[model samples]
Target: MTTPGLAGFIASGEDSQTCDVVVAEVLEALGQGFELLPERGAPRGGRRRTWFDTFDWRLYRAGLTLEYAAAHRGGELRLTGASPYGDAVQLVTGWKASRPHQLRDLPDGPIATSVSGVVAPRALLPEVTVTGTTAAYRLLNEDGKTVARLLVEYPAVAAGDVRPLPPRLTITEVRGYLTQARRAARIIAGIPGVWPVTQPLLADALHAIGRYPGDYSNKVAANITGRMPAAEAAATILLRLLDIVEANVPGVLRDIDIEFLHDLRVSVRRSRSALKLFGDALTAPLAAPGTALTGRKLARFAAEFKWVGDLTTPTRDLDVHLLDFEDTVRTLRAAKPDDLEPFRAYLKQRRVREFRLLARGLRSPRFVTLTRDWRERLTAIRDSANAGTAATVRSGQSRRAVVETTGTLAADRTRLAFAKVAKRGAAITPASPHDSLHDLRKRCKELRYALEFFAPLYPADSYGAVLADLKRLQDCLGEFQDTEVQIGEIRALATSMLAADEAPAVTLLAMGEVTAWLAARQQGAREDFERRFAEFAGVDGQRRMAELLRGGAA
Candidate 1:
């Protein structure tokens, strides 16, 4: 069956004058099953509009209610299911039918209308029921296909001085009037695009409610608060989804190419990580019937596709190449004019290649798909862990297991950072001093993170010394690295122009100046490193880090 959904925009005036008009229109069209949510003080400035305002209407004939709420803050109008506990199964309307009513021309007069029986649900959609003089209209599309039968009613009319209309024509006349009123309102107050105010997960829950026609309170709650005993069930489902996606990646990549394949891989890894992080929260609500299958399936998939370690290798390699290229440019620029021309062509070609590689690495369609897949997987993992049903003892054990697992991940992250730094540092050619220094700075950052992860586990004295030395190295290297990066860019640009046979003299001149500048910076970095290397590479530094991690002391 098609999903039941609604989409609309709303506008509110500062004085709340337009609010009454909007409400009257809604009441006249959808009936008095709607009520205004209590105003919660002045809205914070520049907040997005939410579906938490104005009138709610219920049509008992269809066992459904449409709750309309508007936020003037961001000019958002939300139309969602009115039932507080269940899914929005009974409401069936296409996108076109779900569009919001536009407010139109306003009379310079006071408007009063009473709407009741629109109470908030403790959870999920609100509870509402249509009441009093109601009328039903066969809503038709431009093609004259019956879209939906809208039942609207007004509360008992008190002594009013307005023109009276026949019962049969009440709703039809009101619909026409509302259509015009909404149009005028729009002219007076322009409508804005739907604002992104809610969390993605919450939005997903709302979507699910609109999509599935079942009791979805638990699902909604799980999504909104990320809390639910049955979260494991959802997470398990998510895991399955990931597996399905991952399984298809190779084939999809074959059709779409390598870029998307790479993205798919990354997505799989991220999804796995996210699930691992929130697994506990997800498994709390699931029963035994499918719980084991869920856990084992996820664990198995993760183990089978465990390639995060492998993927990091390429990332590290690319980083090293980038550093090498930077150093080459710097070195060439600093070289004497006699030595610059030949290297100029080489440097230009290399820079272009590097840029292309970097672009491909980042922008591949596969990568984008993988990223999305990963997000979904993570969500699922969290859901599963939250939903899983285990004995109290088992649950506690799982939590402890998760905590312990974090330590290993921390260690791996640290190791990767150190290794990358060492690799890049070693790859710095004489020609690419600037790129080398940039790599060095990156390495230093990784080292710092590593130290941070191990800090709590290290002895205070040792930790302090290591941190101080690392910091000193970073400070010295940082300055050298910045100059290197700048010089490299300058050298690269010069080389490119000379290679193209354009402005050879000017490019050559600029190249020389940048090269000399880079040489001085490189000399400074090397000298600084030589002086500090003893302290940084000493037993108390490198060896000590190893010893501490191994539960030993320097």
Candidate 2:
């Protein structure tokens, strides 16, 4: 989606040198009935302006923009709605040592209150920087009343070196003069060698610097097709997952927010699942004396990824507890939320220690090797698949006969995964042990992950129906397991706090009430499991899964 802004015109054929010519033509054209009056004391000299967003473009995606200007009108940090004509909430701090990193860094006022919901925890890193000079003119109608504001920009992007950008003309709407503003825009847009700007100036500047807004995302977006070779498809998914892992490393290291570590762990978990489920695709012959390199690499990388996953767990667990601390306390019938302040302090202290280790592990030589070598290996696998496809084309062999495609592999793996879930689920009785339900939950998760991995191979409607059924079952199982874990963790925390002499008798009593609350939740989830699983393995769900399997096979 394009960023919202005023009706803007960018030079289509003219460079910055000849851009002034277009502006001249615009003025001459408007001379017919409209008059251009320069705003007195409007700066003609350029000032540096920097746009900031989360690495994932959280602000931009939310239809908001935040910028700091060195001297545009006056030095200030401004946050505005998407529309260029929208009123801006500004904090006037003329020439500071540094810009605010997160919304909390801004003073508590309209601007801070506005963005607090959007950009908390996530640091607002600068995405693009540009220097531009603007000449502002008021477009007046027949009675000499200003109907619109026109800005002529001479801009350059600051990347490695100063890169001149195409000059732009923007017509901002004046309040109570919508028709005249539209007429003025039409006149400016019709000028030769200019076209209406499709995106914000930030996009243009980012392009000049070889960066883009909203380029980073945590989700896997690999484009896989049924006809693609299994190894290539697996590699494509792994490579995409790897990108997510890498993209989040900086944020993880900085400890910017809980999500960076959360996303990184999720990618690692998915990569492990893909490797185990698609192991056959990676079974290449021996490379060195008596050693199969592909298998060896797979095993080694999987172990390393597991280690990396383990490293982040401690900190992530503590993060979760702290994040949910307020809500968890609210569930207590007798204890006020503040009664658990000691417990909150203990969680924070543990998190700081755990996070130090996490950061160290991420920066270690072992992790460096894992990311670097894993990328190279995945690339080689993808290239090998491409080469095999080329050979099959040349020799006139059927694509399926020469290499395993996603169609065959997805069907085979998904069938096995589904059968595993069905078999385990069928064995569960109302009187079954919690361990039995936990084991079945594991199988359900595996099946869900397999469906997610190969979703591109099936029709969206069929896939969605099947996944919805599986997700209902999975959610029930997840809730049951999570509550049980939370109960255990709370007990452990109580013990540790007592041993450390940190927990008073009152704090322990509060924790006991919280534990009772969690036990009730776990029992509720356990009771609901039977119904959720019945729906998951019900006739309609089974039919959808069969259709999905057939679609993949076909």
Candidate 3:
């Protein structure tokens, strides 16, 4: 019943006392049905191993693991499944670098291509590194075909001070040899002082270094409850948002990748959205002297976050521009992409300047004060709710605890947001001004954020259905807005370039052509908006939204 490719830890005492006897017992347990054969040139000792994953553990979440190992001869990269059953595809890359932070740093090959596909735009950071000596043996059946493989590893943490870890035995099942692999695993488990490993060895190694995989994530994961105080719920979400914002700051400063800044800005924006949607929910009176922590008090922090968003916008916009430049070039009507090289150069230069400003702002005392004060305030609100502090609504009505629960508050907010979206969307006519569509887009975004924030308080199916409809509508709005913004930005950039004497005649013409194409795209989005809105506002979608609202109340 043992899982193939299962790993077990061997007690140090038993391993040291009966190392040879343990191997003999495994061989004997095979009962001559299988023969043990030592693999030729197996690494007995002194191989450096490093485990790679994104900061968010993207590969681990995707059920894959990437490992780089170097020996006296060369290095090899292996991409393996993280399942109990071993599955691996490897490339024998020979010592490309000490460490590659990004996919581009990896040599061109299948491994690199596969990794790039998974961890797009995120840096592949070394999660754990260890020096281990492994002895490999193959289990062969009577037909002389390998049925299973076993690796006995003696690993130590590869840090400043060497710390030895427990020895492990890994039973790797060959394809179509599940029975043989299970037998090997059973024999190993039966051995005295050997215990099955619940987690992977990489997790163990990471623990030695006081780290764990998937420590950072950009998603909002507030565990809000139906009966929980709204203030506490809001604080929980804001605190998590702050954590995301702070975690991404180091990556942003290091310029590790563009995603860091993007994630940070998104966290800040989401924090602001939470503040807006949860405004009524955050009415719990604080234990502080006199004044309550109302929207007025939070207004300052909201402004500070707005500054953070504005500070990061320039760099992020340019990043989007450069990232989409190739596709834009391909869509051009007249000028060659090469003609836009000067404009691209200008964008890069502007990005560097904007990034410098951004870094300075982030490192400034204002940011430090904002984060620290924000955390303290939010924590105080959470503690006040925990203490069950009395609060009053702004209209001077005594607050009822039931009405102030996360579920009730979320339901009220969701209804209001949906109503706003419905009103704005219904008002839009085919001949309505572009500004009208833009205004409705903002309303749709607010509704989308409300649903997402309070999703845990509603039924999954209902929430999902409503969200899917909204997302479809949002996609159309997003495409339309993006093209509109790009058109304006291109025009502005063209003017600036001309002013700076940086734009050649060809580049100006190319910019004009790209702007025209973007306008056409925007027109197409505008034309298709009615259908997407109709689907979002359809009877089925409305029913789901109603059900979601009722579910939250329940």
Candidate 4:
């Protein structure tokens, strides 16, 4: 489709001894065979102006133009142009920026020169007439001899088959046209009639050539023709690209910023959605990479890059840690001789670990890679869910049956995964890293709930009790896990500060008290969960529910 925009070129230069050199370079760059128009004199009323008869420059820019007339006077500059949507027309009395009188008064010479043309709007087909005009003015020095020259060109063409033109002009084309007009104006002004020129005509010409359709409009059209499933995909991609440009490469390129990392996450999400929406069009090679990168890789990256995301929370956590550590250090520093050494050692170790974790997270490659991978996995899962839904719908089963079947399958898979996690948890030794064991337990809870979502689809009498029990267990475990995490962080902070040799004795002692209290809290949470699970298991609810479902009871 023809993009609704316009493109053209303009060139202007001063009329001086150096004018020939500039004009020659412009013409060489623009190529040969462009027509030139006859020159004209300055406007009356001491207001200098010039016009061109005819010139042919390339259509390099197209866009809308706005015009306004001077309220005091009837005359105005008629601005005609194009934008992404349609043609533009503007009329104004004054120029955009005023020229210095000293520059304007360089002995009366040609005051202005311009070469302008328009790319036929999309509405015009096959054959369209392109018309342009150019004019020149001469300003005389006080001696009455020509000291400056001005040239302006209005070039218009009546041509057929211009429909084959590109939707927008290239940068090279626009630059060449401007160069030529400037050179040409300089060359013509050397003749006695032209002097005292302004470059406004050149500026106008450049603006005219820079007009063209915007990228958004073109991309939208392309996506529609290409049968993209979601209209938002193009917008999303564009936004993501803009984010990358603005964040990572605001001025100089190289090295990703924290903002860039965040933007990258957003882009991956949108790209994944696009891929799934247009899955039919995407080949395996294109889709497989996304899946492969996600999962384990993404999980690892999230852990490593955890610091950038941690900044807000970290500052707060650090403040609290510092305050407590400082109090403890003060106490330890002023403590009785019996407690001094131990307190000092503890303070020293804590600082080392906290700073180390902070420094490592900021520049970890593994973290970046894992983040990319996780995004890939998320997209893959979303795509798979969509595909699975379609397949189920097409299988000719009743809606209820289809839903039930899919739910059951999903629940079973989750159950199996979580069962493995629970089994692994039992083997976790006291020496095992807290994060590893904690993550495993968390995964178990996720699996349990993933199964519960399908409970309603199963025979109510059969799975109802099981679902309820699973939910109860999940809630208990979730709380327990959270408390555990808090305690870990608290302990890590306390230890780091103690090791730093900076925390006071009082701060160290207080942190120790807090750590002990949290440990007690953890014990209480575990005991509560244990008691609840024991009651659930002994009630025989699972067996009763199973029998009811198997018997086909409502």
- Among these predictions, the greatest lDDT belongs to 2
What ranges in model 4 sit over 4 Å off?
1-405, 417-440, 448-495, 535-554
Model 4, span 1-554: residue lDDT tens:
11112122233334333444443444343233233222243221222222211111112233223222233453343334433323332333443212211122112212211112232111111111223323343333334433223333333222322111111111111222444334433443343322433323333333344422221121111111111112122222333333442333221112211223334333333333333232222222222234323334434433533434453244334433443444434543334434434444553454455545644644366545544544444456435434544665688645344332333333334445445554565555545565654565555554443333233344555556665765676566666675576567756756666566556766556556655655776667566655545433434743543453333212
> How close is each model in CA RMSD to the real structure?
19.6, 4.1, 5.1, 21.5
lDDT of 2 by residue, 104-218 (tens): 5677666666666777657777777888788888888878898888777888887768888888877777778877777877787778888887887888898887777888887
* Model 2 TM-score (2 dp): 0.87
List model 3 lDDT by residue over 136-221, tens digit each: 88888889999888787878888777766777777887888888788777777777656777777788888888987776778786
Number of the top TM-score candidate: 2
**Model 1: lDDT of residue 171:** 18
Clashing pairs in 3: none
Q: What is the descending TM-score order?
A: 2, 3, 1, 4
lDDT of 1 at 527: 72
Error of 1 at 311 (Å): 16
Against the reference, the lDDT scores of all candidates come to 0.41, 0.81, 0.80, 0.37
| Model 2 lDDT, residue 452, Cα | 82
Badly placed stretches (over 4 Å) of model 3 are 1-43, 82-100, 135-150, 159-163, 171-185, 210-212, 286-292, 389-403
Which runs of model 2 end up more than 4 angstroms from their true locations?
Answer: 1-6, 13-15, 28-37, 44-52, 62-124, 138-149, 158-162, 172-187, 284-293
Please give each candidate's TM-score. 0.32, 0.87, 0.86, 0.31
Better of 2 and 4 by lDDT: 2
Report lDDT (Cα) of residue 219, candidate 2. Answer: 63
